[model samples]
Target chain A: MIELKDVYFSYPSGAVLEGIDLTVKKGEYVGIMGHNGSGKTTLARLITGLLLPGKGYVRVNKIFTTDSERLLDIRRSTGMVFQDPDAQAIGETVEEDMVFGLENLGLPVPEIDTRIEKYLDLLGIRELRHRNIRTLSGGQKQLVNLAAVMVMEPECIILDEPVSMVDARCRKMILQHIARLNHEGTAIVHITHDPEELIRCHRLIVLSRCRVTNQGTPHEVFGQLLDEKKMDVPAPYAISRKLGLSPVLTIKALLEELCRSRSGN
Target chain B: MSIEIRQLTHIYDASTPWETIALDRIDLTISKGTVFGLVGGIGSGKSTLASLMAGLGTPAHGSITIDGEPPDPGRNVGILFQQPEDFFFEKTLFEDMASGLLHLGLTEEEVHKRIHSTLDLLGLDHQILDRSPFHLNRGTLRLAAFATVLTMRPGYLILDEPTASLDPKSRKRLVEVIKRISGDIAIIYISHRLQEVVAVSEYLAVLEQGKVAFTGTVPGYLDWATGQDAWEYLPVLNQVMYGLQRLGFDVDLNVACLEDAVEQIRLSLERT
Candidate 1:
């Protein structure tokens, strides 16, 4: 659903991304990870058409992102969640924020209301509908941001460190919702620094020093890409490896392996 | 300096429609040279408590004392806000660091000397003094902000989600620096990342709905939180160990880091 073709992007200071070629098929969950200044956010902006590539192109839903005529279509197909929750919000109330994008699209009032209610319930934030956005905590505001984007029913969602501000409880809730949405065939591109969040992603892409250095499944990437690149491995994965066992990303998987081995499986 | 808070209650926009009882009759204390971790979900009064302790705002009820005197936010506490930019407004790092020092009646030479020494303490290069605070990367900005705070040398330091939005390398570096200096200053670390909290903090407090839900050492809180419904608040290592405990594997939930967890798991398996 999303593709980047030999893309090169730069700012006034320096080139950020170079020789990028990638694609995300329908319903694919792609985890993009790299350290700060690794051009990860720039890639997200490029795919969402927020920033045009300096050279080459980015396409969403087979439509060139640079095409002004199809700008609305591009935006409708891909929703981008930014890193900072406070900066991205424009609405005074939670419900208002959820409907902001739809109202901008000039959808019917009843349809917008229906969508707002549906998504808020889906995210378990229905009770926070009328509350002032400023009063909500960082995690709640982020959940509202997610509801705002998902209410529009985009084909693909690009989340840029959505859970970084949230507490562990709310982060899990948000990730579970993202996983469910992806399972329902909406493509997901999650940009983050945490390895725990990366396990659910079907494919992993690592960018470094303005280039794509690694791309593979979670296991493949964790097996060597993380260590070889000096990337941060999740604590569970690192601990399992330290104990001379095959490292598993998730806690549930690790527990299963431990039980199996202890029971002489 | 030690801090003692008793019957603390804070209400934002009180007696109005926007009224929020951010904190309710909370009592706490932070001794010198120890890391006190304040953890809670969003809107659970964590920031309110931090602000109150930092003297950013006045508590509507109760009392706060620093070494048997009323706490002074300006003189006794240094708070690194959730956003680095919140604590900075100058055009350059040098000016920002100087702004805080100028108020202390220090001469230019003295201010520069203090800033340089503070930067050295935080392991920041003096070259960054020429750059704009807005232009630096997140990690550098964080360290720059740290230098600004350390220039004051407040007895109490309040850090709100210090590692959020930071890369692993930056996070590790910041944690190491905090560890290096933790013996001298009392640190009140507020974060949802329980692993980092466990690693840095010697004491713990879990806030729930504007109340102190649990308080104790890392291991004590882990045992208490594991049986509670707030499973997400548990650190990744503890969560995995809790799962192992559920599966009938006698595992210790107190392992703080990956290395500790590895040792614990090895010993558990060998015993099995």
Candidate 2:
């Protein structure tokens, strides 16, 4: 439901993204991979209407990001979840945080409460409704942020390295929730440096030196990761590729492929 | 010098309503020329333990000794906190790196020489020396922070999630440098990322709820964590091989990097 057509962006120091054209259809999971200073964050900001492109267009739900009149509507359709939970959280409690976003949408009080309950239940964090935001764990806070964003009912969610600082257990938990949301038909544009986080994505886009160097399924793009050296591939995938096995993203898939090969099938 | 912690316990804001026990009767030791990895979930007191080890604060209970001596902050130990850029204050990176060295009576030339050598080891260009630490990118800033700490030439170094927010290139660079300097200086590596921990550390400890849950070598820690149903934090390769064994695959799971894993898989396939 998001598109960037011939987008060119630059900073005062130098050029960032150039001649970029991309589209995210409804219910698609797009994993954006890039190194530091690789314009991944800028691309996400452009799609969410937080930063307008210097050239070309960034459209969300057919609304141009450059259009000030419909900027609010664009943001309402595509919510952004940042890396640090403490920075985005404005409320003192979990319920308050979720409700704060809903209130911003100017929804009725009862409707806001209903939305908060629905998302907390959906994400299975209903028990944390009254917990103090500061006391919550990093993963818990990130989940609260996701809940807050999802409570707004955005068609597409753009997450910018949301799990980079989270612990392994909590990272898995958050990824599971995101996977579920994507399965539920919410388009996701996930910007991450973690290879494990890229496993469940339907499509992988690798950005380097301000251009899209690789774009395809995880298998297709990561198969060349070793040779290209443009982006980092998951260890299992790299190992599988090196071993002449199928370039599988997850360990289970790699084992399945190995088992099939062992069985001569 | 070996750093030792005997029955260490610390409580935040003790004797108050908000008093919380951050650490509890934890005992550990880090010998010289050893890379000790501390793995745990968030708020498992990993940072608190690192602080105690660095002599940032006194333990509420028990004791810590550096080579059988009490801890002296900024003397024999250096700590690289997560987001260490927050610890920077000087206008320029050179000034920040030289902040702790001037007190040692080292000449400006000696400080500059040491900083350049350390930056080279860290794979950082010397061009960023004049720039503000805050102006540099996150990856460069992290290495710069490490430079500031390592220049102190502490006998012991405590790195708290050094690679947490770094990109792949930067993470690889840091990992290489950690491996390079690990032989001369004792390191207490604390991180939730098991891949880096398993790669860098010979000794691994798991912290669960402010207590030492498991402590041993890398392979032993993996087996213990797996047996304890805490394999969730193991690196993907370890988890995969372990899963294969659980599924009746005749494969070795002790491989480290992607290359070793590939060799192991190939050998397993050849046997089958």
**Top lDDT prediction, candidate number:** 1
RMSD of each: 2.3, 3.1
DockQ of each: 0.60, 0.47
Question: What lDDT tens digits, residue by residue, belong to model 2 across residues B27-83?
Answer: 887889989998888667888888888888788999999998887777888898776
Candidate 2 TM-score for chain A: 0.91
Note the B-chain TM-score for every model.
0.94, 0.95
Best by TM-score, which number?
1
User: Which is the leading candidate under DockQ?
Assistant: 1
Badly placed stretches (over 4 Å) of model 1 are A226-229, A244-247, B13-19, B69-71, B85-90, B103-105, B227-230
Candidate 2 clashes between residue pairs 3 or more apart in a chain or in different chains:
none
Total backbone clashes of candidate 2, pairs 3 or more residues apart or in separate chains:
0
- Give the C-alpha miss distance for residue A199 in model 2, angstroms: 2.5
Give the per-residue lDDT digits (tens) of candidate 2, residues A1-265. Answer: 8999999998765788998999999999999988877888889988988788888998888888888998889888888998656668998878887887778888999998888889888766786788778666555677788888988889999998887666777787778989999999999999988767988899999888899988998878877677887667887788777877767777778878877887993
